[model samples]
Target chain A: MIQVEHLTKKFGRIVAVDDISFRIKKGEIIGFLGPNGAGKSTTMNILTGCISASEGKALINGIDILEEPAKVKKMIGYLPENPPLYGEMTAKEFLHTVCDLKNIPKPVRKDEINRVMKRVGIVDVSGRLIRNLSKGYKQRVGLAQAMIGKPPIMILDEPTVGLDPGQIIGIRNLINDLGRDHTVILSSHILSEVQAVCERVMIIAKGKIIASDTPENLSQHLFGSNRLFVSVAAETAAVEKTVKSIPDIIEYQIEEGEEIGAVSVKMKAAENTDIRKAVFSAFAAANQPLLMMRPIDMSLEEIFLDLTSAEVEL
Target chain B: MIAVYKKELKSYFYTPGAYIFMGAFLLIAGLLFSLQNVFAGDSNYAGFLSSLIFIFLLVVPILTMKLFTEEKRQKTDILLLSSPVSIIGIVLGKYLAAVTVFAATLLITMLYPLFLSFHGRMDWAQIWGTYIGFFFLGSAFIAIGTFLSEVAESQTSAAILTFCGLLASWIIDYIISFVPTSSMAGAIFILILAGAAIAVFQSKAQDWRISAAAAVIAIAAVCILYIVTPDMLYGLISKFIAWFSLTSRFQRFSMGILKLDAVIYYLSFSAFFLYVTGSRIENRRWS
Candidate 1:
């Protein structure tokens, strides 16, 4: 539903967003993953028409954002990094104002406002001033504001940034529900949150998109080696030797354990290779009892660090 | 546009800005009304109204200081700009909201004239004319304030800059008297103005070609005017200053002479400033 081609944004001498191109299919929940100052917010700003791009074009459902901003902007509901809000106004009043600005039909505005407020779990605080609300509620109010018009496309920049764990889970569930119908694009520095909520992840660094793929695929592709941790009732050196004898074992590390006569060994296997049975048989031949053997699936945290740190190296 | 207008108007009251603006203006107007009309037994309400222009130097900044600056400070402009509304709509809505408050305050002051009407003979035409002029003049000032607010980074700076801008306009007549009236001085002044315009253009467009072309056109036009009517060059400095003399135009209205040209001039003046305000906002997105 959205196509950004050769998008570039420059602030005087500093290039905020380099030549970045990506396509977002309808109903796809895409995560913009990057550290602070990695052009994630800049890319979001350009896509939503909040700022002009120095070069290239953005299209929403075949409509050019720049050529016909009014028309294209109607289809998008954007929640900026700060959640543009009027502190003096109540949440209800703010949403009403947003409804009017979005040009929603008058008859449905009230119902739409109520529905959005309830959806974001801000219904009880609707009448209270936004300034008086807690940060989590304020963030929910911002989310409600973005969802008010029920626009087909929603661009939320760090929607769950300031929320508590419960609020974060609520917001994640809300985003998951939203992804069923709306084309959602959310940005965040939190890898687990993005992995939990987004179907596709775009890892951005240094104003460029380093990788974009499914969360599982990103973790797997970036972590090509399969790792297994094993604790054996044998000497450290003997355990290392036994694990290294496996045909596909790429590397192994042995460390002394706290328990008497016990040693812990970590084994690394080649890409997509399952060395579980091989290691079991090798230790069995050595007459070494295996205390524990567990495969380690690369966590999103490892993937994020590896990808971002790898970019730093490049 | 109407939504933005209503929301902005409500915001003034929701915050302390609207009440403060109204209270401050009424205090000044009440003091002037009592001193000039009630104490002196003068029935000329237009004079009092004319004198109240200086009050705008203080209250107008209060009314408009937060128009765009506060939005930016709060980051709420993102909501407004990302919506379907046009930038012109947003600017005009906010501008009209400020003017509406000014008009509401001006409406309350009509009771001062009602009291004069009960106590003495009143010139209804002159009072109406002065009120019209005051409305337009105040609207123009608000437009200037709106433009100033867009350019300033904070509410304090916007308020201070607006005060300085309005004060400059108020003192422009006094400043004009000290300017050199000789034709050579006028020629030099026009050249300096042209140079400033060229510099502004160069910085904005970042292109020497456009600035050079503009400079050439300006110089050529001035030369042609000098050769064609050398007499027009005489006292040109005063005339140039007079063009910006918004107060001078108000004089005709205060005299109960509602000149169409003056009305058009005031309106176009406000419109021009508002247009510049809109363009500045649009330019910010690109920069």
Candidate 2:
């Protein structure tokens, strides 16, 4: 339900978001993957109407944000990088304030806030001052603030940055649950969090969208050759010799296996080649038992590094 | 807007700012009341009301220092900006909240006059008029503090800057007395004033051509004024100072003379500063 066209943001001489364009459909959970200073926050800030873009425009449900910010802002809930919280106020009071800002009716504000607090699991700390809460609770409070009005879209920047591992999982599952009805857009440094929670991934670098696709497609399409890790019940030298005999195996690294009297070899095969059968046969001929073999797929972390740093062509 | 107003008003109480301001204000007002009316047996409350402007100058910064600077330092401005509330709503909401605190404190001090009414006859009309003037004057100072709070980076600096700004206003008449009132000096002063105004407009518009045109037109207008009525140019600096002199207008209010123009002057002065504060906030998003 959000469309951005050639949006660019400049802070004096530095370009934060440079002519990047993307669209997010309704009920789609999109994850922004990038390193620090990748303009992810800037893009989110522009879309949320917190800051104006230097060029182009963003439309929420076909309404220009700059032209009608109040109407557009009503449809989007934003959680900034730092949770915009008043530490002196209690969590419940903070949510009530957010409801008021969003123009939620007074009678239903309490119920709405309680529902969100329950959803984000911050109900117990709702009465405690936000400043006294731990970081995890504060983050949940931030998330609860975004979910109070149940707006159609939620734009969260680095939602799981400082939370513990368990809390991170809870927030990830919460985002996944939220994606059932809400269009979820979150940015995080944790690759696995995005991979687990997002339906699609957009890799941005230096204010440019380098790649956008599903998690599986990104790993499969960006990876040129097949890589296999095989364990053979033989010495390292014999495993290396067998690996050399197979011309399909372009590169190989042999190391000792965890299994006694065995060697594990990681090998890269030619494009689309199935070295599993060849390795099985070669090891069988040598009277060496083939213990295990499996193809290795590139992880999202590698793809991100490749796209962001190496600037790999799609 | 109501939400922001309620939150800001409640926050003032939640922190020590409101209490400190009110405590300090009431302490001084009480001391002055006891010393001037009780000890001196003075029936003149106008003098007492006139001296209360000093209280506003001392404590207005406390009431306004955190209006925006704290929001910014805490990064809570994001919540306000990203919400459906307009910038004008937020500014007015905060502005009115500060004014409300100042008004409530003023109301508490009404006991001073009520005690005076117990003993003998009092000029109720003049006393009420002075109260109105004091409210407006304090409001004008609060507006100035609100604008400076947004301009400063931190609360301490905002408070210090606001205090200095109000101090400058207090001494504006004295400064005007020292300035040369010759026609040549007035012409040059008007030219400098025009230049400063054009410079502010240039910074906001960021167009050299428009700014240059404005500067030329303003210079040409001043030159024409200088040639046409050199006599009018004399003492022009004092006139300009009088136009902006906030305390000078207060003298009329304290003298039991309720001038409509002075009331409008105080109101317009507050509105002008508040409008500039709103523009400064809107410009923040672009920057």
Candidate 3:
């Protein structure tokens, strides 16, 4: 339930967020993918009402943030790039303060705090000062702080930036868990994290949104041609001739295979075209046994690089 | 606002800030009280109360330096700003928290007056009046300290800046006496002030038309005053500076007289600075 229209933010002469527009439906988990300084944090900042946009507007549930910030901000739970924490306070005390800030009723404040602490898996460290906790625990506390009021929307900026791999998985699972009831918009440079956790990914580069789609669709759309990698027990020239004979195969490359008298072939066919049967029959006619065959799809990481790097070239 | 107030108040005690301020302030105030009253057998509590302002000037920085600068340095302001709380609410909450610590410490100092009352015939009117004045004056100073804290980037710098600001206000009365009293000088000073106000307004509003209109109106007002009544402009510089003399108004209070205007002056002074603090914070988000 968030909408941004032609939003732009300029810091003096430097534009931090160029003209950008996007909408997120209720309960949708959206990820902002970008390298550092790509306006990911800036956009999150604008959406959370932590900062003002220089032009255009952002709305939450049809309410403009600038027009009625208090009402709009009440609906959002934001975890900034740096977790906004007081070092001297314990994690429990910090959550209590957040509950107060969120206007959580006194009667239910403790229960809410406990629920959030357990949800973020920080119940063990609840009594410890936030400063003494490890990085992962501290981040969880930040997450818990955001989740205290159970707001409808959660905006996390690089939620798992400094965590260990296990912690990263923990946070990703936590986000996925949140997605069941909350609309989540998180930003990160880690492509696989977004691919694994988000229903949609928006690639932002140079203060502009370059691509927005589902993880699978992004890769499939970028690499329109279907690719097949095959290994055949035959001479390299024979495999190459057999592959070239397939009318549906638009491009082919034959290389010597690792095994003796074996050749590997890589080929691309038109979109939605299945050249597997044609290649099988041709290879069968040539009496070259097919050792292995598998379809190759571009990974999210590769698609991300291809898209973001293309922006740099422009 | 209550949430922010409680959190800030708790933070004050959680760190060494409140203790340091109260300890240093009480130690010095007690030393001064003992020297002026206990050993000398003097019952002139007003004199001791007046001297306590100097001690307040020193320790107030400790009470206020981390109010906002620490929040900025720690980046916790993001939490406050992103919450549903209004900017005014946040500023007022933090301001009241600092004032609460000051009020609590001032409450302890009541023992000094109580001891004097037990020994001699204390002027209750003068004592209570001075106490009220001292509270408001200290709050005004805290407001200044609060604004300085918001302006500086670090706690150390905020402390230094707040101390310097209080020091300037402390000596402003003395500085006022040496200023030129000639109408021409007053006219020139008023022009400079108007120019500075216009510059500040221009930076904040970014509307040249409003600045130009303000500049034109200020010049017109000054010219009319210069021509119609030069006498009104005589010694205007000192009078203008005296208007901001926070301590000068304490004379009425110390003499056992409660002037309504003086109380209002202290209150409005605090309100002015607090309002400016809120605006400064709001401006930061936009910038």
Q: How close is every model to the real structure, measured as TM-score?
A: 0.95, 0.95, 0.92
lDDT of 1 by residue, A4-91 (tens): 9999999998999999999999999999999999999999888888899999999999998999999999899898999899999999
TM-score of chain A of each: 0.95, 0.95, 0.92
> Model 2: DockQ against the native?
0.83
Whole-model lDDT, model 1 = 0.90
Clashing pairs for model 1 are none
Which candidate ranks first by lDDT, i.e. highest?
3
Q: Residue A212 of model 1: what lDDT?
A: 95
Give the worst 10-residue stretch by lDDT in candidate 1 chain B: B182-191
lDDT tens string, model 2, B143-249? 99999999999999999999999998988978888888999888899889989998898888899999999889988888998999989899988888877678988
Supply the TM-score for candidate 3. 0.92
Alpha-carbon interface RMSD of model 3? 0.6
Candidate 2 Cα misplacement greater than 4 A, ranges:
A256-261, A312-314, B195-224
Write one digit per residue (lDDT tens) for candidate 3, span A1-314.
89999999999999999999999999999999999999999999999988899999998999999999999988999999999999999999999999989999999998999899889999888889998999999899999988988899999999998999999999999999999999999999998899999999999988999999999889878785488888999888777778878897888888888888888889999888877788789999999999999888888888878888988898
> After superposing candidate 1, which stretches have Cα over 4 Å from the reference?
A243-248, A258-261, B200-228
Candidate 3 local lDDT, residue B57: 96
Which one wins by DockQ: 2 or 3? 2
**Fnat per predicted structure, each in turn:** 0.93, 0.90, 0.95
